[model samples]
Target: MLSLFSLAHAMEMAAASSIRTSPRASFLTSSTLKCGPNFISKTSIPANLMEKGHKRASLFSIRSQQSEPKDGSVILPPTSDSEANAVTIKDWEIGRMQDEIVSSQGIRIRRRPPTGPPLHYVGPFEFRLQNEGNTPRNILEEIVWHKHTEVSKLKERRPLIALKRALENAPPVRDFIGALKASHLRTGVPALIAEVKKASPSRGVLREDFDPVQIAQAYEKGGAACLSVLTDEKYFQGSFENLEAIRNAGVKCPLLCKEFIIEAWQIYYARAKGADAILLIAAILPDLDIKYMSKICKMLGLTTLVEVHNEEEMDRVLGIDGIQLIGINNRDLESFKVDISNTKKLLDSEHRQAIHDRDIIVVGESGLFTPDDISYVQEAGVKAVLVGESIVKQSDPTKGIAGLFGKDISV
Candidate 1:
């Protein structure tokens, strides 16, 4: 067994090997979150994807770096921030980048990615969301904006470096895509990624008596190939403790940490908490952030469920690499308007061909409440379905799975 110190060293060595960037890069020319190129220190780095040992790649290179660039080399650091600066800059920069990401993709929406570090804070680390035009507009947006504060607090309590060490003791990740594919081949139906959801903004308190472990066990017994646990505490009433408990309880189904991830630090945090996969909403994250974050997720050995609500987002995602699973959310995140046909609308033949060509497994998410709903998405080319309200609200979630498909899916 490795000690914590040994594990952190191993993670650094592995990170150095995995985090190579491109050399042919110039610094940013656009107006970005420039609070204190100013504030961030080495310790402020959520996870040192850019830093190899004591040295770090240039902020420029780290910002635009890709998983597999034609010219892969970490940029030379122009300068490092002071301890005060690092804290100030990161606090200012947290949730703002998501909006910037959306704009970079050439898609215009009322909502934007986090534009910069956390600027709306009381102290150095205690932060809040300002009513910037970049601020959140809808319930989902408000939840995301609030998450900026919540996650910053979480990260402040447990820094990225600490999470890296904890990962050494985490459960070995199951093959998330492999499980879905195997279940699909066996069931002749969409593989179930049964949702361990507690509450939603649209529907308050999915189950009055919510037991995450109990629901996860029921899903496993009901033949779910994978499970998704809502880990956000404010809106969803979920906690990472729930994820840890489900893992400790020893259910074999791989777990997806269903959090609104706005920063790379959340990826490492998820792995440390025993999550095998994490959600990356395309609606929320821009293309570059997705590319950068997805690369980080790969380095950490966490699978990404890149969620998209429409075609433009789908095209942007297909343009990225190392993405194996794409989730087509039937609900419009901005409007909270759900239409099951959104799956078919986005996964048209051209998109399906591109997805098939690259061997991407498409997942139909939300508004899937029936066998017909399941079949519709299956015919539309989804290999899996992420169902939450339909099953979790049922008295017996295990039987709910069978009723969902109009037959028993468990072998």
Candidate 2:
């Protein structure tokens, strides 16, 4: 029988050949790795076949082995927690393929890199320089990455258990979905979800004299069905404290915690902070995450507004179950370009049919300014509209709502 070294060398040769045939964006270097006994699959080559006096063949990674897959993906026997955290030889090579798949679908947001443990050898640690793919191409991606890092730090300060206990004493959630429907019935037009905006990355300092509580009260008086409170402090110049303040001020309108929710922890946190509902951007989350997080929100008695900017994102949200509110964003998160037509484009006959058949509520968001703008989006197929800039910029946001609808529906 050929020796293990010869067998391994032959495998590496074959793997390298396969990798070369693919596109260059894969960024895979040639693998001519030397032999370790475990490099070969235990099933493919009998364990007894390994000659004596070699490192007992454990997959050190298919770094340079004939035993690995032709594509150079290292498939080790399910490792312990420690090994799981350790960065193996071909970790990045294999992961590069996964990154390519996520990026191929026009999703420029990269997954956080490997977290190899600081004290390796027994625990799982992801190998991240902490900024692997963090250099975002656009404003949306930058905000998402920043939020991911921000949430990770926040979790340490207030773990989920602590947040859960906070929820115990927290006020009960209002009927956020019900409020929107009630307003629509009261008024012949779409329900208004007025935003409490202080600032945005795209539009800096919406109101220099910003009072979250005051703004919330104004929206309520102006006939807002619900209020969207920007809780992201850094980018949006908002805070969870603002949400808590609005709730404490006895503003009767149901509150939507508008933040970049990257983790499930934030949902519990928002609920604890008196959020009646939460916003889930489909662009920032995968299908599975949206599904899982929506379930968590349901458990917490918090409604979710699943936001989508394009047809692809809308399709992914549609594929999910238990999504009650779908917000079609006129502003493309990736490009930061606002087009009210985006609402019409995404809600084609097929999408509208599915939404109607399911009795789902479609919310038109962003770039809505005039009566014509409101009517245009309403005609496109939305039961609700989330207005921020046009209304928030007004001297009296109460009048802003009246101007938005062209009449005082509050009475």
Candidate 3:
């Protein structure tokens, strides 16, 4: 008598052969194929496929006994009802199963190559929607969707184990959160956490000479409380190498790894790559994720700079339990529009009082240049400012920083 495991293994073999033979056969045999390690039969057979004629015959006889024939001559089993219900080749479940099999076997399946519409030169870059019906609801939704997709792809490519290993051995940088709190208490002035960014999707390339370590040193010399480094490779043209280099360059300022914070894995990865703090954009993340990630950052001895662009975002950041530094980004992330008035708009009298009561360090970000711009945001209730382009573009970025502050910040 055939053991249950042997019977299941035979069934799986039959199913595999049936799938290879015809789409019809695949549907007929799929129901019998069991999926588990214990399902593999311990039955012995000739090692070679060419020498297994008798074994094949015995398997066929067993299948024939299990499935009744329909006609005078022995008939093959009926295809599955689901297979019959399929309207077209594209809709066939058996075809999908075949694709999955091919994928599992590590085979590259390719469709027929497109024959030609002669490629014509387009004068300018054009935005064409691939699926018009599947439009995002708004700019915020669009960015969130993009972030989700990007993060999913990253997870597949870099598993969590690898990220943890990277984090465990990563170089350490200065802590932005600690620096901010210390500056606020000591000087009664918010810590100057300036960002070093090159290009943004919304606003092309902001700075011409983009050297991460050099920029970091300049910020340190200019009396910046911390340094924000863009570490996104695709959009920002940044890398972990930049963060590592900045830390190794002997710059004393705490470094914030400016990235789209989607997963806790990324936080660990940042810590491993010498990041002292991270920017958690309130626009994309829900409050729960923010709070959870903030706690994780604290546990890792890292700081979290919760960034907000509007009143709703600000309120959300405030509601989170452990946020110490609040960065008010003047540049609208979705529309790529920059307005200095955004700092003033969000930091109203009521909000200011609430922030002061909590002793939160508010850092004004983007569109800052010259002494007037710096003074404008400072007077409007921002204790510190994040300026990138105007300062970085100057012959000596350190001088540009003094020019913006209008006094020797180094002194």
Candidate 4:
């Protein structure tokens, strides 16, 4: 059986590009395909096409080679045992090939499992597979895989062309970076990007009575320069509705749509929902994707806050051009571990010098609690901080900010 991960990957790729089938291969028509949570399509493939030597030029470059009869129904030839096995083997190859490209860029997380270990036959007996490719290796990988399915379905409903039309009524863009800069100089402290998050996979529910707009207003009143709204509904328990609601609520602080962004389509979606800035995590995105997505944000008048967790990710972001804002996250997305030193470690003398030369603003993210924590990252060269949990959970989040920075920052 082809795993859901494989199906999602194949369908997403097919939907993304025009189908071009080779004349020699067997073709599955759209009638044979069904769409639903429980629906699965039983399609046939020729054994020869699954051979090792056959390959595509790129990850998205998929080629189909089957022809359909005039009646729209084609007879599938009976498959031998070896041929039946070849089907899954080919699926495994495609996933492995795509993963190899990501791993080559120093990324530890695999986009998807290289489709579990191939079936092993030992003297006419098959060994049971212990671990499967459908299982995610870490929290971050799991989130990315889930996002793949979520985005695919969302794109289907609101296609890119439709989303473009909605942009006509999207609220005007705000100066996200300017707000942070002004707050930093005004307060002589790290400008706050207070996160309006309700829950997390690691931290569970942080606020039982979560009012996104109320928290946003409190943060702004407490002197936050920008607001980071968690827009992921599955794991974060946040939604784009909250983003739209907050923006429509008349909050003056610029909004950052904090999402696990994997596609350029998401950029347009965020802008259409009233986001003034968007986050791009260097850990999940490769260099090419970061560059491409950053350009898209620029065109949409949205600031890109490229986040880095380690020195390697920091170095990769530094190599990219036209990046004005960089966020150093102290938490490890994979392990869900928090360490304040991660901020200080990545912004070393060498990287700090490069950032200074390029005029990139570093924002310290996560694992921040007190005045000492803010001061530590400030000393490490972060001009701003993206903080959550500590403030949002307090009875009065406005007073919480005063405790965080050791004084009232409200002007």
lDDT tens digits, residues 15-64, model 4? 32322333444432221211111111223333333222123211211113
TM-score of each: 0.73, 0.74, 0.64, 0.80
Candidate 1: segments with Cα more than 4 A from true spot? 1-101, 106-135
lDDT of 2: 0.74
Model 1, backbone clash pairs (residues 3+ apart or across chains), number: 29
The lDDT values for all models are 0.73, 0.74, 0.62, 0.78
On TM-score, the candidate that comes out on top is 4
In angstroms, the error of model 3 at 334 is 2.1
Q: After the best TM-score superposition of candidate 1, give how far the Cα of residue 16 lies from its true spot, in angstroms.
A: 26
200-280: candidate 2 lDDT, tens digit per residue: 988899998888888889899999999999999888999999999999999999999999887788999999999999999
lDDT of 2 at 120: 12
Best by lDDT: 4
Better of 2 and 4 by TM-score: 4
Model 2: lowest-lDDT 10 consecutive positions: 117-126
What TM-score would you give candidate 3 relative to the actual structure?
0.64
Tens digit per residue, CA lDDT, model 3, 82-157: 3221221222222344335334433222111111111111232111111111344444445444555676687798
